[model samples]
Target: MKRLSVEICVCTKCVMNGAMDIIEAVEGLKKLKTQLRLNSQVDIVTRSFCSGADVCPLVCVNGERMEHSNSETVMAKIISLTSKDVK
Candidate 1:
């Protein structure tokens, strides 16, 4: 299976801006990946700080930065990335 990295910023401002919610949602996605039968494995990581504080809720998927990110957008990105390699 392919591996994907997902990083979430947990800085003070980010946490206040709903980082926890995003984390939970992403975790749910990881748990459901097997059921979804995707060809990718998700690795969720937390960063203490991210330069994009102005855009509090930040997410990075496979080293690609995403600002103003929410659970929906993040999940969509993951699905899209995995689907690309599906056969």
Candidate 2:
């Protein structure tokens, strides 16, 4: 199973832009994926700050950075990345 690495910025700028909510969403997605028996694991990490303060919330998935991240968009990116591994 491939492990998906996720990073969420928790800087003041990020939280002010709803980064906390994104964390919750990612947790929810992790639980849902586990319940569904998906063959991959989501490993989420929190960051104190990133260079994307201007963009506020920044998310990184599989080493790729996403600017102006949001729950829906981040979730979609994860879904797309995981589904690509399905037979």
Candidate 3:
């Protein structure tokens, strides 16, 4: 199975923006992996801060930076990336 690493910036500013929501959404997604037919394993990591603090909430999927990230966008990315290997 493939492993997808998701990093979320949880600095005070990030958290204030919406990082917590993204984290929660990701965790919920992990729980529904089987139901979603996800073929990859998701690893969620919370980091203290990232260089792109100006953007506040930031997420990286497999090292691909996503600035100004939100729960919907982040979850969609995870699903889209993992769905490529579904077949």
User: Model 3 off-target regions past 4 Å?
Assistant: none
* CA error at residue 1 for candidate 3, angstroms: 1.3
Which pairs clash in model 3? none
Q: Any runs in candidate 1 off by more than 4 Å, and if so which? A: none
Tens digits of per-residue lDDT, candidate 2, 1-87, equal 799999999998899999999999989998888554556789999987587457769999998988899999999888888878875
- Overall lDDT per candidate, in order of appearance: 0.85, 0.86, 0.90
lDDT of 1 by residue, 1-87 (tens): 789999999998889888889889878987887776678888889987576459879889999988888888988998889888874
> Considering every candidate listed, which one attains the maximal TM-score?
3
Q: Whole-model lDDT, candidate 2?
A: 0.86
TM-score, one value per model: 0.89, 0.88, 0.92
Supply the TM-score for candidate 1.
0.89
When summed lDDT is taken over every stretch of 10 residues in candidate 1, the lowest stretch is 47-56
Q: What is the model-wide C-alpha lDDT for candidate 1? A: 0.85
lDDT of 3 at 71: 93
Off by over 4 Å in 2: 34-37
